[model samples]
Target: MNDEKISVDNRDYVGALASGLEVLSAFDVQHKKMTLSEVAQITGMDRAKARRLLLTLHALGYIAKDGREFRLTPKVLRLGYAFNASNDHLDVVQHYLQSVTSELGESCSLSILDNDEIIYLVRSSAAHRLMSINITPGTRLPAAYTSMGRVLLAQLSAAEQKDWLARAQLLEHTDNSIVDKNRFVNMLKDVKQQGFCVVDQELELGLRSIAVPVFDYQGKLLGAANISTNSLRVSMQSLIDKYLPALQDAAKSITAHAK
Candidate 1:
């Protein structure tokens, strides 16, 4: 079977269009306001190239300047707006995620698998912070390391999962992080069997999470939803014994009646 992607663009596949988007992506939450040198450093481009792109973006009103630094303008939001608007159920999902945060007093999020990574789309955080970096919409984490990611990954067929494991470089993010491919595969099987997963400080120190997959009314997989809390504040047993049940119940309620 042919697996190669067919090009629909008449222009060169590798061109200015790609570079401009790459430049935009390089300016994330941590590096939002950046100088030309910062943009070049983030994007791995020369200063001249980064400057040209930044200047072009600034001229187009997609970016604004303050002295020597550039930051994305409201126009950048239009891109996110388009995505939000197109996804019909995102707001509904986001509302429920917020409700979970309110009920559990923990951070809850809905994320979908994107190119082998779990990209959070809806995030409802409790008043308290959980990590050095604040959790927000569009945050991405390694799929193999997150409870949400693992539950979503469990939805993949056996063959697809095998291919992913073969290609994935399972890095140990922490001492507790699962680095062995065999152990990872077994964990996925357990997730599939149990219909939920509780990861206790596996991805990061002092952070624990439990996740369950979400499905539509017709039983189509939507994504996975998770509630994360601090380990010191929430015990490991509570995460597995209590948090997992809460998340699964929320997930079932949403799927069965959230519409």
Candidate 2:
């Protein structure tokens, strides 16, 4: 560790690398295409610094530029590819997800919490239409309003969860979205007690899901898995009663031999 050049050594600040990665991360599902000014505004970085980072990213082929706006290109996928290749466990998790989808005839996903958001690491679809947005390995969703989010959050300690809840600004994506602190806290507790979570029409109308946590052999929380389906196609009660078991089973499968 002494060889590591961290910020406190009267040298380069760790914040610089973090800020550069943040600039890359800011380009996501919604903010895929943005101008230098847009990146500056979104990331709160000065316009000059944002421009430098964007230009560097573009030159490195992680991004593409056309006129005033810039967007991520296929080269950006290399980052994800590298991550997937490095983590051999994701393949095992993906296989479990595929099994769950095959068994339940529903869409299944393996996701990990990332910076207060959930990123789908692997997803298997059962040919049934679900959320309006496409669900794929790279798909990202808000951690606050998703069953997977709640399930992953449930894995956190009570004190850490409270700290997260305090800073979180709950967005009302739909009328049913829970924005109240007490109710949200209570719901997280319920998720912990039940060992699973269900979100009904909170993320999107007709989009219902159930999620269970996946752990590693050493009992470390690895991630969460979920099955998402359309409400019209499957009743909420059935999702909780029927799909929940399948999802939890898949979680166990992923944990049993994830690598």
Candidate 3:
């Protein structure tokens, strides 16, 4: 479910807890460690509020303070571990994704839409790297510019899609990136009709990927599974004629075993 849909005025909505979690999330790969002022700036909270949250997290063993900077501790991993432990289907996804990677000789990933971004849930990397940055689990990328992201986004209802487009910042990442909202919406319609998507050098130059939505046995939408490769090494036709079938088979296997 989209937690962002929840109203802040609701009785169950704990603003302090939400703010604290937002502060924790603010420390990512780029901002690994931050001072109170830095955290406040990143999270848009006042320095005093940020300091209180940081200290509270430090007291709870989730954040560690070294001199003046605060960084996430190993205890923070427990939150991710709890998610992984509860989802038994992840192992099945990993196994099938690895098989696809071994057979196709390309990186395979499973990603779910979160807000306007797609979060990588599982990844099986081949020898070659498609992107300049490493894409591990928890890596997030713009949903509008990725094959897996498009596949997942296409599954959303019309109102949800409209809401997403209204709030999304459609920036041109590459020359091929679609910045026109109408063009993007039309592309999504095609993706939904075709039951898959192919993003060609949109997010980054020389990065091409094709994705299909994954579903459970009961037809619940799980996420999108994709095979990513360097555009220089793989052509768009090859993605459809070769990698597409293999990816579809893996998605079927995942759905069959997810029960």
Per-candidate TM-score against the hidden true structure = 0.84, 0.91, 0.97
Model 2 scores worst on lDDT over the 10 consecutive residues at 4-13
> Which 10-residue span in candidate 3 carries the lowest summed lDDT?
1-10
lDDT scores for all predictions?
0.85, 0.86, 0.94
Of the pair 1 and 3, which is ahead by TM-score? 3
Model 1, which residues run further than 4 Å from truth? Answer: 1-15, 46-49, 257-259
Model 2 alpha-carbon drift over 4 Å, by segment: 1-12
What TM-score number comes out for model 2? 0.91
Native-vs-model 1 lDDT? 0.85
* Model 3 CA deviation exceeding 4 Å by range: 1-5
Task: Encode model 1's per-residue lDDT on 82-175: one tens digit a residue.
Answer: 9988877777787778778887899899999975689888888889988778777888788888999999989999998999988898887789
Per-candidate count of clashing residue pairs (backbone under 3 Å): 0, 0, 0
